[model samples]
Target: MSSTRLLVIQPSRTNPPAALAEWLRDAGAELDVVLASEQPLPASLDGYAGVVCLGGEMSALDDLRHPWLASVRKLLAEAVTRNVPTLAICLGAQLLAAATGGVVRPMEDGPEVGGRLVAKRDSVGTDPLFADLPWTPDVLQFHSDEISSLPAGAQLLASSPRCQNQAFLVGTCAYGVQFHIETTTETVLEWAAADPEAAERAPRGGFTRDGLDQLHEDLAETWKPFAQRFVRLAEEGPRPNGSLGRNLPLV
Candidate 1:
């Protein structure tokens, strides 16, 4: 519990959100990060305290198009089997679902964008990875598809009104949050500027840089509590019976 090293799996060609490195430092994690463009898939998980999967443009369903996703799927499975605390963001969450006995698809619930409000699922009251502090919290978002279903035996934790499986617990006490609480204002701008129409067309408030900055300052206290709690879980390891079954396994 004292010396769990955190592994950052970044699938994006662009740099990871600034919040990631900052949060790792704040968590006192011995950090090691890798990008998809630089390294191949299924990198070693041994000695990694927890696995942090970051988002990217790739879809989790197209293993044939992006072979690296296949490797990530395998890696997530092994990490879960070993009871590692894995937090998958966006595409990573999709990968985690596809890795376990779940499906990843184009979301029918519609795209969730900007600073959206989310209620903590009943399961969040005493979650080991997420402690209670607020009835609802708003977070940044980016993604077209989401995990349509959870792995067998997983616990539902949090949900934005739009997405039912916004957060989940996959044995090992491992957790995944679909919304990007790890985003900063600058990162928000960087992502939003990618598409011109996104500034006002987003379903949620995450578009304007000014709006995001204000919210980031406001949410600092709220999200930090969850991030800190996540660090503890990463160090101490997930609760027993957190791994998925081999028979009811991810296809």
Candidate 2:
């Protein structure tokens, strides 16, 4: 059998797939990373078994500043329409929501930064990508925007106190998470250095070396298998009629 082919989209230079690329590769998927800021995005999802859109520093609505964002949103929409397994992270998740009839805006409470926990919703029990995750999974939160409302028919999977749309599933295969499961401690420190104000909003000791180290360890323990399961889902291809044989309620 051949390795699964996944398209990884990096919307900003500041944020790359980083550890998530390694995790996906370890799960037997071949990644084709597109730096959307520097490269042209594919016009279609053909030949790709899955899609992984990484985080970025830019706002999902900043098309004037970053024209390529429009293309990225189109690509995400196409991925969902075709039932291609997709995992959109952070800014990518915001773009996915915005492209799919959902709303994205500056977070009302403020930027949610630091290592945190998001409780899995009951619907996640039937989700292929999130079903096995612990009740509350550790994740890195570094975004200033939130998915205020999900796309119609989108299934809520996990949520945090500050942000309700922590994770969601669109259609049968597209998944989006508002947190970072792909960052290394170094990656987040770079984000912090660039945005001191947001960094300040993190919980006490959240960015300390000890704290971040433990957080990444916990993330690996919980999200690595989730990534692997995503690979398996991609390998299995879309299910019949795009249904998993369970009723996932819409939000």
Best by TM-score: 2
- Give the C-alpha lDDT of model 2: 0.87
Across 177-213, the per-residue lDDT of candidate 2 in tens digits comes to 9999999888888888888889988889347777888
lDDT of 1 by residue, 34-147 (tens): 776568654568777788888887788676777677777777776777777888888888888878877777767556677777777776766666657576877766777877
TM-score (C-alpha) between model 1 and the true structure: 0.89
**Which residue pairs clash in candidate 2?**
none
Q: List per-prediction Cα lDDT, in the order shown.
A: 0.73, 0.87
Where does candidate 1 have its weakest 10-residue lDDT segment?
242-251
Runs of candidate 1 with Cα error greater than 4 angstroms are: 1-3, 41-43, 203-206, 246-251
Clashing pairs in 1: 5-49, 100-250, 114-206, 115-206, 171-242, 172-242
